[model samples]
Target: MKKFLSALFSLCLVFALVACGSSGGGEASGGESEETFLSIGTGGTGGAWYAIMSAAGAALNSDLNLDVQATGGSIENMKLVTNQSADLGFASPDTAYFAYEGGREFDNANPDLRVVMAGNMMYEYIIVRADSDIHEMEDINGKTVSIGAPGSATDIVGNEVLSSLGVEPAETINLAHSEAATALQEGTVDVMMALSGVPFTAATELSTVEDVRFIPLNQNEIDTVVENNQYWSGGELPAETYEGQNQPIPGINVGSLVIADESASEDDIYNLLNTLLVENHDEWEKGHNLASDFTIEMMETYVENGVVLLPFHPGAEKFFEEQGVTLNK
Candidate 1:
């Protein structure tokens, strides 16, 4: 009787251990699907970056959980991705290059930064009141200017352009795109120096209320800003792009990028891209007007044009390759 009782006790212990293993085991052993949760850092809600990323997050909800966080823009996004605070983010091509190379602004080089895909082509709009004396880029000296949000692509690039053009503002303020537009409308600011896609929403909404015109950067000025920078290009806003504008407004332009941390899983990134770009193409594109630019062809063109300046994430490289797009480094 004693031997039989001891055998029963041992059997019960074995059964408990098996049950614990099955219950506590991870997806690999438990036959459960692994759920990936990620966060995307974007620019202000009123900007194209936020709109495009938010739409993507919504479209990708079925496959994985994504949180689109509004950020200060390019510089902050770079810092967030490098610190693993954000799994993915957006940045100007020049900003991404700067972060990777630790150019001036960055304290140290971030080797873990990788480009997931190309985004929209950003255009600079040096906006001013239509009736103001600031008719040309040279007239900005000693005038109050809103140089975009602090640490954003616009702030950095706007300063660079000002320096290149030898224009000095009396004071430079940092404000979100919409806020700057409001300030301009209220005469609190003399000019709004912004970098965004065509028909920048803030500018558009402001145009409906106040008379505004984009300061056209002459060919020489455009050339000067774009010189020695492969990431920079020239863009022109055709006439009628904004109310009260009768002529094309030409300016400097730069490509935008969607970047991811190097530590992220390649297969997961590939799958996400496949779902966003292929399976949910229609839905994703319909998310925002700018979303239509988020296409594989646009990425390929950016690479061909030397607008995409960073190394592709391994997963992104795999996904693009499957679509017959060769990423040049």
Candidate 2:
């Protein structure tokens, strides 16, 4: 009787251990489940960045099994990703470089950021009253030019452009794009520098004003500016994009980058890039003209553009490799 009782006790202990082991395995499997939600940082309601990213996020959600959220604009977006408050966000190459290098805005940032993919090219145009005396970039000195809104990529880029021209923010009027347009139209502000996508809404509206015209930065000056600061590249603003303009305006082009935190797994980045480049191409094109610019050839051009300035995340590098393309490194 003693032996039989001891054997039953052992059998019961084995069953308890087996049950605990099964429970542990189940928990581990649950922990390894996929991340289902991602947030993208974009700009204000009327901005193209906001519109394009929002649409892309929705398409990614529906097609790639992702739950994408588009929140505020650039500065906020960079903060979200760097702080791990967001999964993905949009960044200008200049902003990305600043964030990575601990430059102006990211001087206090802890986690250095990187770029995942180059998405679009945005031009920084300075729009002023057509009759205003500000015919040259230098004329902005000591004038009430709107440098862009607070906490915006426009503000950052605008500041850089002004600084490149030896202009100081102290001499400028700091206002959001909308406010600048209103101020210019009201004759309260003399000029406004807005860094935005082509056919920018704010600039378009400003152009519609009977007295508003875009100020063209000289190509030689633009080249010199970009040469000194690797972040800015020379680009043209087609006059036809704006009202009452007959000539292309020389300006600076900054790249829009799709950025993610290092915490995002390789597979997640790979899947995101794959979905944007392959599965949802048509859907994206239908949403924005900028989407049409996203092509394999353009992707290659972005890599070759020599101004990315930020390190490509390993996952992005992997994607490029899979496509039989080598990164510029």
Candidate 3:
């Protein structure tokens, strides 16, 4: 009799668990799907990518009832999304394109990669103390220069530009943005290349302590770089970007494409993007200055800017199409 009671109790417990599940989830709750948890991969701390994406993720989490986390930057972000460690990523178009094609730094093709949004970024320059005598791109030939850290967008772009310019600095130090800026201020490094939106925090801060000057690339130099490399757009750094700067400086600007993994559901991607652009526009702006530049037009015209070499995700494609914006596949 005792054994019979135990078996009956076990059956009842299993039934209760099933009942609980039926009442709580899996199409039983008004046929609505369960909330999804997501992660966004961003750049390192104190950078524009991290600042912008973190703000967007927070806004999505609150308004859409989703769990979202922001971590890492550029190349790291691409890996995180490809490996399914992150559902979304913010990266330069060149980096993502290389990953998709199995070229450049990556050996494997990630054909499943797709873009969600295209955002703005500007050309950063090789910074030096204004008082110093390093005047042009060729001036740094025999000086100590800190290239950006490996696996960084800055490193990739800077290396290409330097090689094209035929610059072989006396010493090439690999340092992150902040460290390179600090070293420049301390006179430990003669120059450092930065590639981000204008008024980069570290470079601006460095300007405050020392009148920093950016090495300007002339139109011929710009044409030379873009002749074989179409990933960049030729532009000028507007005035007042840094201390004691009153004139625009010629440079190359490239934008970034925010992408997502293919495994994510269309509904979730649609909802998250809709929440980001429509509902939380103002809130997301609190994250960075470039937040105001996130618009449908950017994504639509990205190919013209050479900022998008990959196709958009189906969900994103549908959303844009609804607004009469026909993207290039």
- The most accurate candidate by lDDT is 1
Off by over 4 Å in 1: 1-34
Per-residue lDDT over 1-329 for candidate 3, one digit per residue giving the tens place of the 0 to 100 score:
99999999999999998787677544545566666666777654545666666667667653244334434346777887889888888778889898777778787889999988877765757788888898888898999987776677787788888888898899988787778888998899999887777756777777888878888998888888877577777888888878888889998887888888777778778887777777777877776667777877777688555567788888888888886776776
> Across residues 1-329, which tens digit of lDDT does each residue of candidate 1 receive?
99999999999999998877666433534576566777888888778788787788778745477788989999999999999999998999878988998975788989789989888888888999988999899999999999989999989889999998899999999999999999999999999988887766788898889998789999998898888566788888879988898898888877899899899889778978888888887888777667778889999998888876678899999999999998887
Per-candidate Cα lDDT values, in order, are 0.86, 0.73, 0.77
Cα distance off (Å), candidate 2, residue 164: 2.5
Ranking according to lDDT, highest score first? 1, 3, 2
lDDT of 2 by residue, 261-290 (tens): 877878778877778777887887777777
**What's the alpha carbon RMSD for model 3?**
3.3
Of 2 and 3, the candidate ranking higher by lDDT: 3
Candidate 3, residue 100: the lDDT equals 76
Cα RMSD for predicted model 1: 3.0
